[model samples]
Target chain A: MHISPTPQDFLDQSLLLIQARPKTTRITTTYSTTSPSLRAKKTALWLAKKGKPTPPTTTTISPPTPTTAPTTPQQHTAHLTLKTYDPVSGTTIQFVTREIRDVGRLVGVLGRAARGMGGVKTQPDTVMSDAPVPTPTPTPTPNQAVLHVAEADVPRVGSPAPTAARIGTPGPGGEKQQQQHQQQAGGSGGAQGKGKKKKGKK
Target chain B: MHQQLLSNEEFFQKLGLLFATTTKQELGSVFLTQKRLTPYDQNPEKSDTKPQEDTLADLALAETPGPVLVRATNGASKQNRDTKKIKFSTLIEPDAVDAFYVRYAEVCKSGMTALKKKNRRRKNKKKASKATKTEGASA
Candidate 1:
C-alpha cells in the first residue's frame, strides 16, 4: 500500500468520484488513470486509424509501443455523467461524457474548483447541513425605531458641524463656537438676500 | 470491513491519520467517494410532512435538499483477504468538502507560508536593531 503525502499525490494514485445534485442540477464525474499497456494499445489503434507507418525506434524518439510506454500515465482520464432533474414536469434527463483525456480540461465545463465547491458563500445552491437556520429579518418595531433614533442622535451630539475648527475637543467651547458660526452664516445669507432684492429694484 | 459513521471532526482526524500511516504501495487502494444525499436520507419520518411540490419549491428557494456524504475507504489487501479494511463516512456540506480539497492542495504547495513570513520579519527586525546598536556604540 502506497501512502500519498498530499492530496494531489492521493488524487494521482487513487480514483476520484464526485456526485453532485445541487438544486435542479445533478452530475457525476469520475477521474482515473489508464494503465501503461492500455495507453500503448490506444496509441497503436490511433496510429492504425491514421494509416501512419511506425517510425524507426531511436534513443531520442521513444516509440508509443507497449515496451516503450511508461508503466502508468502521469494524469487521470475523466468521465462525466450529467443528470438533469425537473421537479415540476417529473422528468429526469441524463448525459454522460465518453472518456475525457485529461481532467484539467473539464474545468471549463465544471467551472473552477474553488468557486464551485470551495466555500459556503460561493455554493448557495447546496444545502448547508451544519449551518444555523437563518432567521428572517425582523420588521422594525416602535422600540427598535426609538433605539435607532437614539443611536442617530449620539453622533450628532458628539460631533458638531464641520464649521467648528476645533471639532471633537471635549469642552463646551467647541459647541459655543459652532453655534456662533451657524448664526453668522444665517446673518450673511439674510444680507445677501437683501442685496439681491435691491439689485432687482434697480 | 464494517462501515462506521463518524462526525466531521473525527472523520478529518481519521483522514489525517490515514495520510500519515499509508505507504506508497497502499495508495492505490485508498479511495474517497462523495455523493449528494436526498431528503429521505436526512430524516425519513419528516420527509412525509411536506408535499412534493412544497418540498421542491423550498429546495429551489433555499438550498439543496440535504448534505453530501463523503466515504473514505482502503480496500482489503490481497495477501490478507480476511483483514478488516478501513472504512468510514461523514456528512458535510458540499461547499465545505470542496473548500477542504482546495485548502489541502494549498497546504501541499506551500507548507505554512504564513509562519515562514513571520519568522523572516522577526529576523529582519533583530538585524536592524543590532546594526543600530553597533552604530551608536561606534559614535
Candidate 2:
C-alpha cells in the first residue's frame, strides 16, 4: 500500500520548495514600471533625508582606495514589484519591497490581500464528508509564524492525490475495522457470561 | 519513515487547487509569465534593425480556474501556429501544466543539487588535503 502524506506534509513541502529555490534578483509584476528618472529622484530624496552631516574633507582627504570591489546584481539591493489583489477594495495593489528573501512573508502578504476580498481563509472543517476521520492536528505554530503556521492563508477546497487516497481508502478499511471490533466484542461478552455461570455453580 | 518530497505533479496539483480556490472566491485571475531578453543584433550600425522582446511563455489561470490557458507561441512547435486556436487551459487539459511543471522543477532542482554537490566535494577535498599535509609534517 502506498503511504499518503497528510496536509501538513504538503504544507511543509511547499515551504521547503520555495525556500530551496534561489532568491530571485528581480520579480516584475504585471503592473507597469515607474519611470527611471522618477525612481532615481525618489531614492535621492530618501538618501538626502537620511544623510548624516560630514566634515568638509577637501583639504584633509585621504588618497583614493586602490581597490574597487566588483558588485554583482545580487549584491545590489533587490527591488521587487509585488502585485496583490485587495478584495475589500476590489482592486489590485502593486508595491515595491527590498526584502524579497523570505517566501513565507511574500505568501502571507498575498494571502492577506486575498482574504481581504472575502476569500476563504479557514481550512474546511471536514475534508471528506463521508468518512469518520481523526481530528486535524492542532497546528502548534502561531499565525505569525508565517512559513510554518497552518492558518488557511491559502485556503484550498480539495487536496491532491495523497489526501484523496487516504480519504478514499477509509471506506473499505473502515468496514473491515468495524467487523473486527464486532467479532472481538462478541467473543469477550461470551467469555464473561461463561465465567459468571461457573461462579454461580461454585 | 521516508520523507515524502513534493513531486512536480503534486506541486502543480497544489498550485492548481490554490488557483481554483482563489478564482472561485471572485479574485482576479492569477498568471505565470516567462520572459527572456532578446539578444541584441551584432550589427548595431543598421538603424532599421529593431530589438524585440522575446516572450517565452505567457499563461493565465482562467477566470473559472481550471487548466491554464496557454498562449499560441509557448516556445513549442512554431510550425503549427493555426491549430484551431487551441486553448491550453489546465481545466480542459492538465497534462500541459504537468509537463511544464516537471520540466521547470527539473531545471531548478538540478541547479540547486549541483551547487550543493560541488560544495560537498570541495569540503571533502580540503579535508583530505589537510589530513595528508598533517601526516607528511608529522613524519
TM-score of chain B of each: 0.46, 0.25
Poorly placed runs, candidate 2 (over 4 Å)? A1-78, A86-202, B1-65, B69-92, B102-139
lDDT of each: 0.46, 0.35
**Candidate with the greatest lDDT versus the true structure:** 1
What lDDT is reached at residue B34 by model 2?
A: 22
For candidate 2, what is the DockQ?
A: 0.03
lDDT of 1 by residue, B9-107 (tens): 777777655533332222223355544454444664465466575556544533333455656665567797664577888776654565555543332
TM-score of predicted structure 1: 0.32
lDDT of 1: 0.46
Per-residue accuracy of model 2 over A91-130 as CA lDDT, tens digit each: 3334443332323344343332222121122345574776
- State how far residue A149 of model 2 sits from its true place (Å): 44
Clashing residue pairs, candidate 1?
A1-B25, A1-B26, A2-B23, A2-B24, A2-B25, A2-B26, A2-B27, A3-B22, A3-B23, A3-B24
lDDT value, candidate 2, whole model? 0.35
Candidate 1 wrongly placed segments (more than 4 Å)? A1-29, A35-37, A45-56, A59-202, B1-4, B7-36, B39-66, B72-88, B93-139
